[model samples]
Target: MVTRGTEILVIKRNDPAWPGLTFPGGHVEAHESFHDSVVRELKEETGLTIKKPKLVGVKQFYDDDDHRYLVFFYTAHDFSGKLKASNEGQLFWMTKDELQKQKLAYNFDRDLPVYFNDNLSEHILDGKRDELF
Candidate 1:
């Protein structure tokens, strides 16, 4: 998450499966560290070049079919770039209070709050998907 003052940056996804308001990120390429991937993904999805990004946590999700995936959550307290929206979706800033008013994409509700509350630890969890996997 990239925060501008009291608000944080989020993307409105266009793809299925947890599509909606979520962080700007993509799959990490082979041999790429989570740090590099977050920076690259942020640029691709939001056109923002971040600085000194910190890892918030690593969350693992398990679906009903036993399919699993992992997400490396990150936060950037400082950055440099112009805001530009890509093919992914719209980009916007909202305070933590405002977040409670909007409908988030998926596990954002369960995961991101930990970071906002000053917890820097990692986490692993099972996902709750309304649809069949």
Candidate 2:
């Protein structure tokens, strides 16, 4: 997530698999570090260069085919360049309160605590019954 003051950078995802509002991120490429991937994805999707993205937590789940997926969550306060949207979706800024009122992506509501709460570190969805743990 990218933030400035009380506003957060958000993306209304166009991808059919996960369509709704969420933060900017993508898959980690081969031979790339996690931190570097964050920087690259932000630049590619949001037209911003992020610095020192502190890995705050992670969100993990499994697909219908039992393929495990892990989303590394990071929060960055230092960023540069003008904001722009990619094929992923539209980009905009919103406060925590404003975000709560918007249509969030699947399971994103359950994932919010990990980003806002200092005590939480992970959002895990045990695929069986779609329960949060």
Candidate 3:
């Protein structure tokens, strides 16, 4: 998440597999560090160069093939760049209440606590249920 005052950055993804409002991020590239990947992805997807993005939480689930998929979540309060949207989606800044009203990407709503709750560091989704830790 990238924030400026009361608003947080969000993307309306064009990806068919997981389309709708969600934070901007992408897969980690081979040989890249997790921290570096977050910085790179934010730049590529949102045209922002984030500095010192603090890792806040993670989301994990299994794909259709039963392979574990992990999403590393980070929050950045310091960044600089003209806000622009890439092919991934349209970008917007919305407050928490405003964000709650928007259509979120698949399971993203369920994943929000991990981002907003200081005590929660992980969200796990099994095929049958959701778990937080």
TM-score of each: 0.85, 0.94, 0.97
Error of 3 at 131 (Å): 0.8
Q: Cα lDDT for residue 64, model 2? A: 78
**Which candidate number would show the highest TM-score if scored against the true structure?**
3
Return the number of clashes found in candidate 2: 0
Of candidate 3, the 10-residue stretch with the lowest lDDT total is 123-132
Question: What local lDDT score does residue 94 receive in model 2, on the 0 to 100 scale?
Answer: 94
Clashes of each: 0, 0, 0
Candidate 1, residue 5: lDDT: 87
Q: What residue pairs clash in candidate 2, if any at all?
A: none
RMSD of each: 4.1, 1.3, 0.7
Top candidate, metric lDDT: 3
- Clashes (candidate 3): 0
- After superposition of all CA atoms, the RMSD between model 3 and the true structure is 0.7
lDDT of 2 by residue, 57-111 (tens): 9888887788889989999999999998999999999999999899999889988
In candidate 2 the C-alpha lDDT for residue 80 amounts to 94
**Weakest lDDT window of 10 consecutive positions for candidate 1:** 124-133
lDDT ranking, high to low = 3, 2, 1
